[model samples]
Target: MMAGLEERLDKMELAIRKQTFRENSGRANEVNFWVFDYDPKKELEVRERIEYMKKKNEKGTEGFQLIVFDLYDMIMEYLEEKDFVNSYGRFEKRRGFDYIIRAVSTSMKMNEDDSILIRKIVEQTPENAVVFLTGVGKCYPLLRSHKILNNLHQSVLKASVVLFFPGTYTEQELILFNEIKDDNYYRAFKLVK
Candidate 1:
């Protein structure tokens, strides 16, 4: 576990619990998006802590609702359900990396209207709930972090979106796995230090 993991989690919880956070007060017109950046090596620990947080704060009642969006799982299930797995691999080898990336991005509906993942995020989230977005590392080369943020900032405006980013968020750009530059997404604030 990382040092002060408990404190960071507590800060996240308290931020999500506060009315101002949900309402986006004093944000200077920024959406209610936050980045909970952590070391990529501690992914399992972060996931465990997230589960603990969810257990402590149940969704839909009593406390604020918490909806987690695991991008890797979402894409896997989607690929399986659509029977695109076989063809997807074939496309990668035949069409080249860039072409395959575009195909997968188009199929995933990234930053587009009627995107299944975006729709799920909007539909599943109730007002004032917390949306935890994980699996950035796993969804690499397909679903970029900035693209999702761009998509959500316009649609899912009510709920507080907390992205469990497995990298560094410098309030300027996202560095996935500390090597890949995920482009600039300055809309979201850093959830904890």
Candidate 2:
């Protein structure tokens, strides 16, 4: 399974490097977006493979640049900068999961914050870049691919974006980690395995 997955990743990298979107394409309308689904149990292994591939691609003269944006790290940084850690820590200590969920939902506008951060990151990326968006499992039930991609402007992001999703994609629906089944999103294409 790992070998097969690696092969798929290689193919995905090639497709991303080769794909080009027209200027008139609307947000989330271009086929430049891809999802790499994998077994949730092998998250660590999958991440390691992706990292290895990223390094390998960087060393080669592929013409396209690889940029990784980890959502977990972004959320942590946002919480730290907003000084909400102490409060969340207290909530976690006292109330546990429920309080933490409520606090996160109330404090962080997940889509808005992620959109801003992603836009900033995308804006800084050079031409012929492939942005790898990861850490979807970490932000389950909060940060969703459809929401983020729907919010992003096609004009600002000239390069392809691949989301490393630890989930299942059946038909057009997305089931994150095999738990949260999302609506059918028509914009992005699934990376063939």
Off by over 4 Å in 1: 1-3, 59-62
TM-scores of all predicted structures:
0.89, 0.79
**Residue-level lDDT tens digits of model 2 in 1-193:** 2346767766766665554532224354653666788778879987887798689778857667788888777777888988988988887888997777766655665446345456566677677777788888987654676666665534367766677888786538888888888884646667666
- Per-residue lDDT of 77-119 in model 1, one digit per residue for the tens? 9889989989878887888879877877888777686587888
**Model 2, residue 161: displacement in angstroms?**
0.5
- Residue 80, model 1, lDDT: 93
Model 1, 163: alpha-carbon shift in Å?
Answer: 0.6
lDDT of 1 at 146: 89
State in Å the error of residue 192, model 2.
1.7
Best by lDDT: 1
Alpha-carbon RMSD, each predicted model: 2.5, 3.6
Model 2 ranges with Cα > 4 A deviation: 1-3, 19-31, 92-108, 153-155
The CA-based lDDT of model 2 is what? Answer: 0.70
User: Cα lDDT of all candidates, in order?
Assistant: 0.81, 0.70
